[model samples]
Target: MRPAPLNPLTRAASLRALARTSPATPLDVLVVGGGVTGAGIALDAASRGLSVGIVEAADWATGTSSRSSKLIHGGLRYLEMLDFPLVAEALKERDLLLTRIAPHLVKPVSFILPFENPLADRVYVGSGVTLYDVMSARVGQKRAVPTHRQLGAAQSQERFPGLAAPYGGIEYYDAQVDDARFTQALVRSAVGLGASAANYARVVDYLREDAPAADEAGAAGGGSDGARVTGARIRDEETGAEVSVHAHATILATGVWTGEQQAAADADTGLEVLASKGIHVTVPRDRIDAPARVGVITRTETSVLFIIPWGELWLIGTTDTPWREDVGLPLVTATDIDRVLEGANAVLERPLTREDVVGSFAGLRPLLQPVDGTGDSARVSREHAVLEVAPGLSAIAGGKFTTYRVMAADAVDFAVRSRFPRSRSRTEDLPLLGADGAQLSASRRSLVLANRDLRAHGWDEARLDRLLSRYGGRLADLFALIDAEPALACPLPGAEHCTAAEVVYAVRAEGALHLEDVLHRRLRLEFEVPDRGVAAAEVAARLVAPVLGWDEDRVAEEVARFTSVVDARLRAEAAETDAGAVEAVAAARPGGGQGRRVRRIARM
Candidate 1:
């Protein structure tokens, strides 16, 4: 069942695979960045039979990939801009992910756009929603979801119940996803397809050498005859171990860190990426009385506001502002939070407050620098651009999460021109790790499985549903953990819905190397809980210590560090100004230092 479960992403496997790859026998492709685009590139190249390896400075989706509105739709705003090609391309990719690529992870979601001016707003917004549905349907064999429909004030009030707008609204369908997990799934799928991937392996420097005998005589080696990028020197963030990897081609999908990475390689990146910071806050679902399960979209002074629904919580507010501060910790200040609350409260029947917030996060979008440098961050083009930053090295930037696969394919197609000319794009029809054959809906098979599991262990329906959402059809993997250790089946402390087995599985199967990685990225308890996972930090650390080779002191250190990080975030969120928030967050940096230190050396 479930295709025997795809290959697990263990820590040992990552280190060993990196050890096995070297410059003498260079990999066909080396991807720098473990975000969605880089992971997708690795899968695309490896699926096409290329020997590929991907490395990240931190965990997968530790950057902007995880900090999105979590929508998989042709940006309706782009339609207003008259950018049809980008919209069409995104719609096609969205359909692909929903139908074939990751059916288990991507699902349709409905959204309502409240209108103050019934007639004028309906005509304006209705046309856009209709066009969005039309564009999405035209890209695939079947309509991905129900088309747009108009609703009267009574109906809108019935659906939302907490409507501040006097006029009725129009509802349309898009899609929502767990952005972090979706990114992790991409990496896991790539690894399953023979791609070597390692998180926390920071690529510090470039490895260059004279052209090989197979190359055109004077094609390489400095100046016009550029030196080829043989590989890169990488450092293990955990143990500080260093190694060099040889790759025929190196692809940089470093997102907002594109400049720093290209600068380390000592080459002109050709394109500049402006870091546009976006912030999101989470509140309990009960705070909003919308029983229709429909997301809310409203216009803000800057851009649009999306109030997406999470399991028991509602994900709200995303402010688009230019950020030039420390990229390591993008903290949300009081002003940012207030801006979000004000925007949402202006339209919601009941307003959310600071006391209602459970968690918040901020991330930078690697928007392409405007030629005139005059437009707002929201007006910046999201189209990806690829360029040869150096011989045998290519970098791609400025694409959205929904279009990562297409961006990856395009980047690989550019990288392999002179090197692996035989390699071709093959990920168009490829499904991710959990998306194999026929996938039973969560309600369909999970209900039966939950009934059996409940009879056997008296597990709650919430726990089973959480497992299905995280693991999809691979719920058997958790079952295997429970079989091995009955005690692990118990719910994790402070995070009752999560099991101790899941924490252990995060390390042994999901390559969770650090306590923070497990809590923040894998288990996601860090933000989901009001304490920011503090109550579960020690429990999680102790549970995962053996698998990660952490002793008592290390466990204590991890727990303390995670607690401090949470404290810092809370303090930053309380700050009145950006400067004060940045200062407070900087003090909370693990070890009072920068996020990850990447050292580039020529003679390493």
Candidate 2:
């Protein structure tokens, strides 16, 4: 049978049903965390015909999942550490995402790993890169990307004129994706497969019995070993309503938040997820005036830094520092920005300064601290671990974003084998929502045309490509709305690449609740453009006002809140010197607005 369509009406009805009807029987699985891993698990379990539901404390990918380096690579640096399995696993998934699963959303991008110390270092790093390419090809994965090649200093300089001279390099291939959109698409696929999911619903506590009740009658089944975690008590963060959801199995994919959830279970899961903050600074394409062809990978003492090309902007980042404060909101500090700029400038002919930074973001990588506690969190394993905290609660942590599918599969495998005992993993060969061949091709052409033709309206090809790449075949769904309402096609006043129609589509179709969702994830105006989408907030709010039933007052309030968020982010970025300082600034920001907004349309 054909799967049901996942549209606005379908999602609304599912939320209503889940809220209204208390399931008489416990669900097969309940996933906590609406990030990539949780969404992947939801899709995996639901596709297998299992009863599944996922609850998130915030909007999808509002956490680390959305704030990432956004690379879908095999972790080339891991090869140097002789972690073959990690590299192999990530490479397989990278191929899957780029070719079979989310072709429209994930595409190949090349990176130039510069070698400052020539001679021995050149041959040594070149050999490692060769292995990386060889292994990728050995898997019989479609060569969606070209192979790597060695470049002399002059040739490398020609490719990336920004590089300071005497830089021999190895050019290799990787993939880039819009992390938030990919996670959202995964949730949508799971919903299409009958999985119930809700963002802003936080699992506050686990329901456990103090003692097992002795059934004198001795029931046919287990006789309620205190019902073995009958369910979880969840608080709807948006509405402040508390409810219980019963499930035979619960999977915790909360990433950095895994520790708190584990503590709530009161079980010695022996798992600890440490937060490692990585900051990325975005600058305009013209700022560097260098060859914008491939990404640049520079070696650092602890981790490698990447100068990635993200559409019209270049994303230079990432400092691997321990985060000691709030894990939920990791902010990019001025110091973090300075560190990245300093690192990139070490290779660039013309060094970058604070003035070149248009925007900055920070995300926490959930690292699995070993029980031995011998090594720092940065050196901790990137491999994922699944532990049964309690009879019904399972927690997974310590993995890279590129391997979310594998982590999801492992979590689902554990849940299925524990609960059903007869089921086997099926997601290894499964495809996401837009992966079908015909739909994928049509989506690509439509995206190209939409971007090319829309130039008359101020959208350049690069902007259109970025949108198409992020949405994949789903671009048509957005354009359909624009076709119905011609005014929706107008570009957001300040955010020229975005249109009023996108905000409406984000709310009506993409499950966007707040202005932040529209600005940050749905449109990416927050990161791609300067002022962090502040100037375009009012126009976006107005565009979605009818759909959300917002009166003039509500629209103005929404706009004000968005502007405050941007202002706070700017202030925080300026005030802090490191990730920790950046987080402090974020802590002081008001409105407690971490995720999506509630949709409230005024009665016409």
Q: Pick the candidate with the highest lDDT.
A: 1
Residue 561 lDDT, candidate 2, scale 0-100: 77
Tens digit per residue, CA lDDT, model 2, 1-604:
1333443455455555555434467788889988889999998888789988888776788888788898899988789789998898888889888778888778788888878778887889888988998878744345767999888999988888877748578888999988888888888888877888777677888876443454311122211234345468888665687777777778889888887887787755446888888989999887665555578888766668988887778998889998886675566677788888888888888878898888888888888876432211112235877765555566778788899888887787765563566776677677776665323345665565666466566665555655666665666666787678766667778887777777787887777767887888778776788788988888888877877778999898888877766776676687655554545554545644432221100000
Tell me, by TM-score, which candidate is best: 1
**lDDT value for candidate 2?**
0.74
- Candidate lDDT scores, in order, read 0.77, 0.74
How does each model score on TM-score? 0.91, 0.89
Pairs clashing within candidate 2: 335-577, 513-597, 514-597, 548-600, 548-601, 549-601, 549-602
Across 514-570, the per-residue lDDT of candidate 1 in tens digits comes to 677788777776558898889898889999887777799988877877777778778
